[model samples]
Target: MSSSDIFIGETIGTAILILLGGGVCAAVTLKASKARNAGWLAIAFGWGFAVMTAVYIAGPLSGAHLNPAVTVALAVKDGDWSNVPTYFAGEFLGAMIGAALVWVAYYGQFQAHLTDKEIVGGPGAQSTAAKSVEAQEKGAGPVLGVFSTGPEIRHTVQNLATEIIGTVVLLLAVLTQGLNDAGNGLGVLGGLITALVVVSIGLSLGGPTGYAINPARDLGPRIVHALLPLPNKGGSDWSYAWIPVVGPLIGGALAAGIYNVAFA
Candidate 1:
């Protein structure tokens, strides 16, 4: 495909991916939403469906490699560097756009959740400034999980390892399963299988670190979380940002290497 086609396809596809995928997080985490407290099963299946939809839509143009880690892994696997920057540009741009749309879609829910008496301020509660300060000091944030992932335990080594392992599974499966070679991109069956793999990873390995197997999926939304104005949204937790990006990348490379060594 032409560069324009690749870029446009990835942009549209990743936007849809994040729209639905992050929409689930908002539904589960945001207050006043019908699906609030919908729980993990909902999130896993929701994300799986999001992947399926995006791949089916964007696969024809860009192979639907919406994650930077996936793009990097594929490049490594194929020894093709020409289109890496194109894919990255499209993915990141699309991710940011998707996150912004999510904000718009759930604006009211975010406001309610952030300004709830329990979260931000109350008679016995801290002021917004105090909350922000305290959260920064503690390296914590509120309502960010709707947009990005965070660890439940906050163990550095273990958290990083969890993301890496999760992403390894993701990239390995995509490399081995995706029919990116056939037709324009992921075949219909590949999309379904890959979507199931996403759900499986979330159910099996998502507990500790929220299973951020895609760098763009996590960081783009995290950036929006930091920039978007909402009442008492708390810190973006930049301290923990590196792990999700770095770990997934490492895992993608490892998966590609393994695929080349064993499966190629």
Candidate 2:
């Protein structure tokens, strides 16, 4: 495919990926949403469906490698570096756009969730006490979970390991199954398989770090959370941001290496 096609496809696909993925988080976490407290199973399935939908939509235009890790893994697997930057640009830009759209979609719910005295601890209260124990340990503010993932425990080693492990599983499936080899990236069956893989990763390995198997999925929305003018929205947890970004990258390269040695 041409570079323009790749860019547009990645941009559109990744945006939809984040919009629906982040939308579920907003629906479950925000107070005013009818799906409030819908729980983790809902999130896992929601994100899985989001992946399937985006892949099919953008597949025709640009093979729909929505995640930067997937893009990187393909580059590593094929030993081609030329189009890496284009894919990266599209993924990150789409992710940011998608995140901003989430804020627009959930504006009132966000306001209600953040401004509640019980949630944000009233006006002028900057304390972390109102946040969950995990958020407090991670130094994240209330409502940040809707925008990004945070560790339930603050162990650096375990959190990074979880992300890496989950990503490896995802990339392994994509690489081994030839999911990206189609004229339409991740064709019908491939999209469904990959989506189910994501759900499996989230259900089995997401407990520690919320399974941020995709770097763009986490960091782009986190950046949005930091920039948005949500009332009383707390810190972006910058300290922990590197794990999701770096861990998936390493996992991608590792998975590619394994594919080269074992599958290729």
Candidate 3:
């Protein structure tokens, strides 16, 4: 594909991917929504469906590489580097745009959810009543998870390892499945199978750091979270940010190396 094709395809594809994926998060997390408190199974399946849909729609355009990790892995596997920057630019831009769309879709719910006066107290939370306005400004609210991932336990080592291992599984599956065969993009069947793999990873490995197997998927939305005008949206959790970015890159590179050594 030409540079414009790559850019436009990835931009639209990643935007659709995040719209559905992040839409699911908003559906389940935000109060006043019908799907609120739907649980993890719902989220896993929702994200999987999102992947399948986005891939089918954008497969012919940009190979449906909504995730930066997948783009890097393909480059590594094929020994090509010309389009890496293009893929990343489109992916991040699409992600941020998708996230912004999510906020718009759930504007009312977000207003109600974030402005809630109910006090939140627990381990890692300060003991006090719900100070929604203050919490939003100080970046100490629970709303960040809706837009990005955070460790349940806050252990850097384990969190990073989880993301790395999870991303390795993702990239390895993509490489070994022969999904890259098509001149157009991930085959229709390849898209379905890849989406299933994503669900599997979420079901089995998503407990830690929310299984951020894609760098753009995490950082781009996190950037939106920071910049958006949401009320009481806590800090973007920048401290844990590098783990998602670094771990996935490492995992993708490692997967490529392993594929070259053993599978190629």
Q: Write the per-residue lDDT of candidate 2 for residues 152-183, one digit (tens) a residue.
A: 88899999998889999999998987856644
Q: Which structure among the candidates has the greatest TM-score? A: 2
Candidate 2 has its poorest 10 consecutive residues by lDDT at: 125-134
Task: For residues 1-264, write the lDDT of model 3, one tens digit per residue.
Answer: 788888898888888888888999999988899999899999999889989998898788788888888888888888988889999999999988888898999999988876665524333444433443354444435677777787777788999899999999998988887655554677878888999999999999998778888898889989998898876566777878899999999899889889989998
lDDT of 1 by residue, 67-163 (tens): 9999889888888889888988898888888989999999999888877766665666657546545665665567778788888888999999999
How does model 2 score by TM-score? Answer: 0.95
CA lDDT scores, all candidates in order = 0.87, 0.88, 0.84
Which ranges in model 1 have alpha carbons more than 4 Å from their true place?
124-137
Candidate with the larger TM-score of 1 and 3? 1
> Quick one: best lDDT, which candidate?
2
How does candidate 1 fare on TM-score?
0.94
The superposed Cα distance between candidate 1 and the true structure at residue 13, in angstroms, equals 0.8
Candidate 2 clash total? 0
Candidate 1 vs candidate 2: which has greater lDDT? 2
Clashes of each: 0, 0, 3
